[model samples]
Target: MKLYHSTASPYVRKVLMTAWECGLASRIELLPASGTPAAPNRDMAARNPLMKIPTLIRDDGSELYDSIVICEYFDSLAGGTLFPPAGEARWQVLRRHALVDGLLDSALAVRYETVARPEPLRWQEWIDGHSAKIDNALDALEREVDALPAAFQIDQIALVAALGYLDFRFASRPWRPGRPKLERWFARLSERESAKRTVPT
Candidate 1:
């Protein structure tokens, strides 16, 4: 298996963390791809039509992309190890994963608005809209932050990654204020093996 991704991409980090948690990291070759969106690397586009980071090409020549799907696939490979087998726990994890995924999406939108688009064309309103979503999601996450388990489940993984990404891209934003529970949770997650290994630098 070959995994093509950038070193500092949070989305890619999600997949890498999944692979590491499942003990599948050794089976895949990690490759770096061109970061240009205008002329994304042909090899990546060949596997993922979207030319997205974190494209997984299996040993059989099959391809997979997108962090959410990739994480679910990894969960399956682990015999449903990362997720609850059934019932309300499954739904809670799914809900938290979905919320944190939204935070990642919003962060990307804000980053692209600033870094990809021309300055004159960049719309503060669009950035503000996405940022509001990220903020609200963080607030909701802080509410039940203590409920997270000590393992590397997808919800906790995605949530910590999402919070870490905010510091990476939006350092000036005040995300830790009024969220002591979430802050403590993130601090603890940072000590985990996967988090320590796959942190975006």
Candidate 2:
């Protein structure tokens, strides 16, 4: 398998971390690809119409895009260790995954607004709205932290990936002030080999 990757992309890091957790990292090859929405890499656009990183090209020449899809594919290949197969546990995990993705969506919106947009075009209201979403998500995660599985899971991977991105891009706005549970949870997860291996540069 070949993966289009950007070292600093949290989404790509999520996929790679999933691969590592699934013990399939050695079976994949990473191809460097980096572009922003304003000027996308044509090479990557050809493979994925959305021009997103973490696009997976399987050995059969088929393609898969989006971090969640790629991560689930890797999990399936590893005999479904990362996801709960069925029952209420599955819905709980999926809900957490959605929350994490929503948090990331708001974060990336803030990034593009502040860094990609011209200063004159940047809107403080928009950034603040997204930042509030991030805060709310963090609060939710803190409340749910005690229920997190003992074993590493996909939601845990997603949470770690999102938090790592916040630390990477929004360091000026710290996230650990009142959320000690989440802060400590992130610290503990950071010790995992997959988390260490996929740290964004």
Candidate 3:
């Protein structure tokens, strides 16, 4: 398998981490790909209409896309327990995954608005709205830390990716102040070999 990879993309990191956890990292090859809304990788459109990173091209020449879908594919391929087979646990994991994705979406919105958009056209209100969403998500995670699964599932992998992105791209805005449980959880996960190897540059 080949993955359209971008080290700076937390979504890509999520897929890679999932692959590593599933013990399939050695079987996959990484193909460098980077882009923004202002300049997408046109070639990626052939494999993924949305032109997103973390696109996977299987050995059979078929493709899978976006982080979550690709991660689920990896888990299924490896018969990994990253996803619960069925029950409330599955829904809880999926719900947490959604929260992580929303946090990342808001973070990326803030990043693009501040870094990609011209200063004169930047909207503080839009940035503030997303920032609030990020904070709310962080608070939610902190509140639910005790309920977090002991097994490192898709949601936990995504949380690591999301928090790692905050550290990678928004270091100046520390998120560890009051969210001690979340911070500590991230710290433990960060020490994992998979997390260490996939750290964004």
Candidate 4:
């Protein structure tokens, strides 16, 4: 398998962490790809029209994309351990995963507006809207931190990746100030070998 990856992408980190947890990390060959909205990676675009990082080329000449799909594929390959098979537990995990992914999406949008856009093109209203989304998501996650499982699953992995991205790009905002439980949970997860190895530079 081949993965088009970017170290700074939280979505890529989610896929990488999933691979590690599923014991499929060694099987993947990471191909560095840095793509932006204006300038996409040709190679990644060829495989995935969206030109997104974390695109996977399977050995059988098939392709999978986006972090969630790729992570679910990895889980399936590992005999389905990462996600709950059915019922309310499954919904909860999936819900949390979607929320964290949404948080990261909003964070990335704010990042692009503030850091990628030129000074005159930057829009304070846009940045503020996305920032508000991130703040609300963090508050929601903080409220549910006690319910977060200790096990390595898609929800937990996605949360960690989102938090890592916040630390990487928006450290000035300080996400841990009032979210003690979430902070402590992330602290423990940060010590894991998989998390340590995949920390964005």
Rank the models by lDDT, top first: 3, 2, 4, 1
lDDT of each: 0.83, 0.92, 0.94, 0.89
Candidate 1 segments whose C-alpha is farther than 4 A from its true place: 36-39
lDDT: the better of candidates 3 and 4: 3
Model 1 weakest lDDT span, ten residues long? 34-43
User: Which numbered prediction scores highest in TM-score against the true structure?
Assistant: 3
TM-score of each: 0.92, 0.97, 0.98, 0.97
Model 3's number of clashes is 0
Give the per-residue lDDT of model 2 (tens digit) for 1-201.
999999889899899999999999999999999888887888876789998898999999899988989999999888967888888888898899999999999999999999998999999999999989999999999999988978788899999999999999999999999999999999999999999999999
Candidates by TM-score, descending order: 3, 2, 4, 1
Model 2: which ten-residue window has the lowest total lDDT?
37-46
Off by over 4 Å in 3: none
Q: What's the C-alpha lDDT at position 150 in model 4? A: 62
- True-vs-predicted CA distance for residue 83, candidate 4, Å: 0.9
RMSD of each: 1.7, 0.9, 0.7, 1.0
Model 1 earns a TM-score of 0.92
**Tens digit of per-residue lDDT, candidate 1, span 14-95:** 8888888888878879888756565567766668988888888878899887887888888788776788777988898889
Model 3, TM vs. native:
0.98
Error of 3 at 113 (Å): 0.4
